[model samples]
Target: MLEIKELRAGYGEAEILKGISLTVKPGEIHGIMGPNGHGKSTMSKILIGHPAYTVTGGGVTFNGKNLLEMPPEKRALEGMFLAYQYPVEIPGVNNAEFLRMAYNEKRKHEKLEPVDPLDFDELLNAKMKFLNMDSRFKERAVNEGFSGGEKKKNEILQMALLEPKVAILDEIDSGLDIDALKVVAEGVNKLAGPGNSLLIITHYPRILQYIKPHHVHVLIRGNIVRSGGMDLAEELETTGYDSYLKGK
Candidate 1:
């Protein structure tokens, strides 16, 4: 339900994405594989309307609406979610309160009434349980003092609560241990269905092993060099990106 065409964007005067194009259909899981600084995360940031980057060219549409026109909060309200590579720690905000506020805002966007805190607590507890997270996490500040895995899990927890139509996970696999990866992947798998889509961006194929993307793409030097099925990821494991990087 997301379409990006000839998309070009970068920080300040340097462009990192050059004519990148891709489509994410409903219920599809697309994996974006690439080395560091090759525009994978840049693509995610642009999609989520990060203000630091400017769109110098091309267009992005979500469910037939002009995504580039929407502000970051509007993007989130419109079902665009980005699980950050490094989830920031908000030391003063209560984790549960922050989540409830966000959830309520989405509800308000839909002209629905905000949920009662008690009701929200029940819902949050259920989601945390599914992710195998401790209830004490709700009491702490957001991502404050959390381990790498915990921060990543918190991101997934947000995803679960929001249930966005298209979730762009930017390096969600980074800093996660094997056990944490499995839990996070399992949560993603559980969330996947016919109504939602996922764009998973990562440098390695380990996360792809669990997520099982319907399509795999190799993005290098600001462009997508190749697109294929899961086999591409398997090949990448053995062959690496040397062949693709040769002339680029």
Candidate 2:
């Protein structure tokens, strides 16, 4: 449901993503594995309209809408979610309150009435149970005092609640232990279904073992040099990105 063509973007005076192109069809999970400093994360930020990067060329369309023209908040309300590699902390903001506001905002976009707090608590509780998170998390401030693994789990919880049509998870496996990684991967797998798509970017392919991708892409120097099925990830796991850099 997301189409990106010749997408070029970067900070002023320096371009990181040069002629990057990829497509994620509804219900399909796509994996992007690349070395550090490649345009994988840059392309993700640009897709969500992060102001630091300017779109110098190319275009992105989501579900037939011109995604580039929409602001970040609007893009999110339109069912685009990005789970950051480093989730930020929001002190003094109740986690449940933050999520309720975000969920209500999306509800407004869908022309539905806001959910009452009691109902919201119930819904949040259900999602928390699915992620194997304790209800105490809903009482604490967002990401504040959470361990590295906890922060990553919180990001996945947000993804579960938002239920974005096209979810871009940037390095969700980073800093996670094997147990935490499996839990996070299970959450993602549970969310995959019709009318939803996922773009999972990572440096390692271990996460793919839990959540199998329909397609795998190798991005090097801002271009997607190789595209194949899950076997590509297994190959990269054994061979690394060295061979992919040749002739690029």
Candidate 3:
């Protein structure tokens, strides 16, 4: 479980998240809907300990541990995963190798032995097959020449391999086609269970159509303005964010 309270963070001297608070309990899927540049991604970055942003106030805890105290790699080892809005391309790194390295690091964190390459291959292949991805993906450089959909799929693949306790998907729906969206969403749904939680941040409700979040939140101007069930997302689809933006 993850708990964020009165979190105030921003880049440099400009503040973006103004005392926002949210809690993600185990087995729950929470959708955070908001317009662009209004702190949705900022929240994700801060949660994962992105150094560019400074936490001027508030606190975050993961499974009762102080999350803000952990470094980014420590955060990942602690089961905090962020699927970025724009997944960076690491041209020189083999996709499979990078994945294996990351997966093994987590194992090492758990005081488990690293898996053999052959065994890891079997594991990676099974995950890729479930995502409907081709085996050739293993040979390609990480997101180097992948399409937008492929990059998003790769992010999901990482999620599957890591099995984080809490996964924060920052704009996972961005740049995905309908087919890609379905595949990605289905993969995500398959990974959800009673032991893990998801925080899906997006501007639109289309992905929620497939993921079916347990709770929906409307964020505007760096703060969560409303929280409800799927009905709030349905209403957002029809009325848009005009009502929330009127006074701002």
Candidate 4:
């Protein structure tokens, strides 16, 4: 469970999130829909503690712990995961090695023994299979020479392996085809269970078909202007944000 109260954050000289607050309860999926420049991406970045955006006001708490004070790595250690919109291609590090280090860090924090390379490989293989990733990708450099769909699937694989308590996906469907989208959605649904939650920040609605969200929030001009059930997505698809834009 995560609670954000009166959060105001933004890039240098530009305040994007204007006192926005939303709560993600356990086992629920919350969809965020908004037009460009509405601060949806900014909200995701700030939630994950990107250095570019400063939290000028308000507080973000996870399971009653203040998240605003934690660094990005600490945030990950606290069971917060973000599927970035544009995952970069890292050429030097093998995918398996990269994930193993990350997994061990999480384990280390929990006072659990880190998995050996062989054990880590077996665990990563299961997640790779869940995402239908090719065996060759395990040896390949992280995101290097991967197609858009492959990169997205790899991100999902990380999610499955990490099993964050609260996952934030920013523009996950971007550049994904129909088949890839379904795969990603299914991975999310499979990982999301009792005591786990997902926050999907996207401009499109098609991904909702695979992972039906319990609630949807409309963000505009750094504020959540409308909060409703899934039907709110349909209204936005048909009517556009002209009325909502004007009302604001």
Candidate 5:
């Protein structure tokens, strides 16, 4: 439910995303595979309205609305979620408190009443159990003392709670072990339904092995050079991005 066309964006004067275009239909899981130094993460940030990058050209539409015109908070409220590559820690805020605030904010945008703390606890606990996360984590500071896996799991928990229409996960698999990776992937797989979509931006195909994206794209030097099915990921696993970059 998101369409991007020839989006050129960058920090300051140096352009990173040059003519990037992709469309994610409802309920489709699209994987973006690329090497470092490219504009993979930059594109994700731009989509979510991160102020660090400026959109110099082109456009993005989410669910038929002009995404480029919305602010960052408006983007999230409009059903766009970005799971960061490096989840930051907020020491003073309890994980549950932070989540509840975010969850209620989205609900408010939907013209719904705020969820009571008691009801929110029950809802949060259910998601925690489903994600196989310990309930004790709810009482801790947000990502303050969590392990790398725990931090990623927390991100998924946020996704499950928010239930955005289009979720863009940038390197969610980084720093995760095999078991942690499976748990995170499984949580993501469970979140996929008829009403939402996922854009998984990752370099390695290992996470794709579990998530099994419906489409895979190879991005090199700020441009999507090739697009294919899961086989493209497997091929990249064997051939690397070098072959794809040769003629680009």
Candidate 6:
């Protein structure tokens, strides 16, 4: 569902992603594990057109559409979902209203009518319950006072609602407890099926144990250096990332 070739992206005058080439097939969950500053997060940001990073070379095509050329909002409308490590908070807007507007906005782009409050509540509530989240969170302000774990759950809630073809999760396990992680991971697992792909950018192997990726790639110095199975993650946990550097 997503194909990236020789992608070079970075901040002004300083490249982070020297060149990244990866592909995510539909219904496959791919894991990207790397040491800090290896450009894993940079690749994720560039995929969605973050203004902070500029794509200097190569191409990104999602579901046969040009990604680098499209605007960020257009990327969202095109079924690319990103779950941020730190979700932003907008105090004035209530959570339900935020989700309502988002669901409708995407539909509007697809030439569909927005659902009414009663229908929105029914549809969104089912997903919230599926995630085992409290119903009261809908009435709260958007991340205004939510805890770190709650923000992550809210992100999963959005993912469940939006149903993107390619979902890129950046450091999703950060600050989450075992229970919260299970809930979040379970929600992702449920959402993983035909016509959907996940590219998870994470550090620890704990989340990988839950998600069970089909392919795992290790990134070193802004490049994908090693590709392996789930066993590679276990190996990394026991041996660390240094031995794999250079010719060992």
- Give the range of the ten consecutive residues with the poorest summed lDDT in model 2: 239-248
Determine which window of 10 residues in candidate 4 has minimal summed lDDT: 203-212
lDDT tens per residue, model 3, 121-180 = 999999999999999899999999999889999999999999999999988988998988
- Clashing residue pairs in all predictions, respectively, total 0, 0, 0, 0, 0, 0
Task: Decide which is better by lDDT, 3 or 5.
Answer: 3
Q: lDDT tens digits, residues 1-248, model 4?
A: 89999999989999999999999999999999988899999998998899989999999999889998999999998999999888889999999999999999999999999999999988888888888778998889999999888888888888888889999888899999998898899888899898899999888877877788999999999999989998998787788888988884
Residue 189 in candidate 2 has what lDDT? Answer: 91
- Write candidate 1's Cα lDDT for 120-219 as tens digits: 9999999999999999999999999999999999999999999999998888888998989999999999999999999999999989999999999999
Listed per candidate, the RMSD to the true structure in angstroms reads 0.7, 0.9, 0.7, 1.0, 0.9, 1.3
Compared with the true structure, model 3 gives a TM-score of: 0.99
**Compared to the true structure, candidate 6 yields what TM-score?**
0.97
Stretch of 10 with least lDDT, candidate 5: 239-248
> lDDT of all the models against the reference?
0.95, 0.92, 0.95, 0.90, 0.93, 0.90
Q: Per-candidate TM vs. native?
A: 0.99, 0.98, 0.99, 0.97, 0.98, 0.97
Error of 5 at 199 (Å): 0.3
Model 4 segments more than 4 A misplaced: none
Question: What is the alpha-carbon RMSD of candidate 5 to the true structure?
Answer: 0.9
Question: Which segments of candidate 5 are over 4 A away from where they belong?
Answer: none
Any residue pairs clashing in model 4, and if so which? none
Q: Measured by TM-score, how close is model 4 to the native structure?
A: 0.97
Give lDDT for model 2: 0.92
